[model samples]
Target: MDRVLLSIGHGYSARALARLLKPQGWRIIGTTRSAEKAGTLAAEGVEPLIWPGTEIGPALAQATHLLTSVSPDPEGDPVLRQAGTAIAAAAPRLSWAGYLSTTGVYGDHRGGWVDETTPLTPSTERGRRRVAAEEAWAAVPGLPLHVFRLAGIYGPGRSAFDRLRAGTARRIVKEGQVFSRIHVEDIAQVLAAAMARPDPGGVYNLADDDPAPPQDVIACAAELLGVPVPPEIPFETAELSPMAASFYSESKRVRNDRIKEALGVRLLYPDYRAGLAAILAAERAG
Candidate 1:
């Protein structure tokens, strides 16, 4: 059985990946900042390690695979800054290492498509931090690093359906506004495939087939939920939180062809509609 170590494994994407990998006979070791979440992870059949610092444990040093979902903080990523040296010391044991990043690193493409070769021009502090972390991880000698630039990730419980049901959904219209998205399942599959291939120092974009207007996604969600579509408001006139407003300022279409062609992954949910329907069905069944 393959041994896998997840440095920041308590996230949505990491949890999903653990679930999928466990069934395939992989021994999973997951790190969590909280002791409570560590206990919860142990109960889920993963070997939970408390990692509140950047140090790497003996178990992590011996693991064959690693996945990091920790986004860099403005101050710096303690985990990467600290463990990076330790991991580099044990790089020979690592078969593959995956770093999760956001498509925001590509910044605004003016609704144009971008791929792995796109030069990074991150607009936000968070995006800049991620780019820095990517460079840091890639510097680890002998480690096969794979960077996955993920678009907006949606899945069963983390979709627009929840917002629509609560009547908080909004269609904020900004001209030339578009964003790409990928289902969480597809994210897991892509990461798993990348791990299997062990691509040395490669970057790949993870997005769905369509990059549509934000309003379109919201309208579709309302239609699927049998709720009235929320009224559209001009971007300039809409009241948005700082985080929400920041999203509207950028327009980029991320391409996933490299991941598809390299990993031979066929996305189960290619668009928001298919993903939303599956989530709705799962919710109803439960």
Candidate 2:
């Protein structure tokens, strides 16, 4: 049987990917920060390894496939700082390695379309950290390093509909502000497809077909829920957290042609409307 290792596996997308791959007879090994989450992971049929800046042991060196969703903070990534050496030591044995990054690395493209070949010029500290982390992982020898630049990820219980129901949905308008987004399930499928092909040293942009304004997405959600659309607020007048406002500063449409051509996969939710419909359906059924 084939085996896969997932670092920082206790995330929304990682858990979904584990479930998707489990039925295909792949032995899943996952790492978590907490012992309690490790126990939960074990119950979910994943071989849970506790890694919290401590020794990573031989598990880092033995996996056939590796995926990491760890984000870099001011203190930096513990797994990479400590266990990266172990992974680098084991790189020669690995088939494929994937690092999840963000489209924020492209910075504000001014609503222009960006593809895999676009030069990275991240504007924010978080995006800069991600770029740095990408460089760190790319430096590893003998590993098939693949970087996935993900857009706004939404799925299941985590959609705009939930916000609308809670009466907290906002339609903040910034002129020319648009963002590309992708459902979490599509992200999993893309990752799986890339793993199957094992593209070493390749970069792929993951996004949906439509790149719409933020207010449009919220209005669509309200329309789907049969509720009044939230009133749009000017960017200056809108109450937004520092992080949220930072996201609005960028206006880029990420292209998915490379993922389609290379991975041979199609997005389950091509846009927010379709994705919202599915989430609403699931909520109704439950």
| Tens digits of per-residue lDDT for model 1, 116-179 | 8989998877788888888888877888889999999899778898888777878999999999
lDDT by residue (218-244, candidate 2, tens digit) is 999999889999998999999899989
Residue 59 local lDDT, model 1: 62
Cand. 2 Cα-lDDT: 0.86
Cα displacement (Å) at residue 285, model 2? 2.6
Task: Locate the minimum summed-lDDT window of 10 residues in model 1.
Answer: 1-10
lDDT value, residue 198 of candidate 2: 86
* Model 1, position 73: C-alpha lDDT score: 82
lDDT of 1: 0.85
TM-score of each model, in listed order: 0.95, 0.95
